[model samples]
Target: MKTYYDVQKFFRRFGIITYIGNREAEIELSLIELQSLKQEGVISDEDYYQCLGVLSYEKEMAIEKRSGKQ
Candidate 1:
């Protein structure tokens, strides 16, 4: 299973920075970045969904960690 760090590393490999703080801010920034990538044709809908999936998984892991459930 992939961990949050793995997801982060994957993004870093592509030169994309991942920010984690203030859930609202993170979501806002992620949406903006994803939109930019889509508009630039750098990623297709499928790729966008895949990336979003990874981000979502990482977010869930973070939540679990913070809640001391992991």
Candidate 2:
């Protein structure tokens, strides 16, 4: 099993800032990051939802985003 620290490190390297918590926090953080990208015009709504699909997979897995969002 991956440790929380490992998950956090992966998120940091990919520029996705997520806090360790329950599934709700994971979903919220993913949404926040997705919204931030949309707000910055870095990703379209279609892309945001597509990415959210990947992030919302498991209950406790780490989520990552593509690197180029401003």
User: Which candidate leads the pack in TM-score?
Assistant: 1
Q: Clash number for every model?
A: 0, 0
Query: Model 1 — TM-score against the truth?
Result: 0.54
> For all the candidates, what are their Cα RMSDs to the real structure?
4.0, 11.4
TM-score of each: 0.54, 0.46
Per-model C-alpha lDDT, please?
0.65, 0.57
Instruction: Return the clash pairs for model 2, or none.
Output: none
Give the per-residue lDDT digits (tens) of candidate 2, residues 13-70.
Answer: 5588776556557666766776777788876677666665555553334333323332
lDDT score for candidate 2 against the true structure:
0.57
Count of backbone collisions within predicted model 2: 0
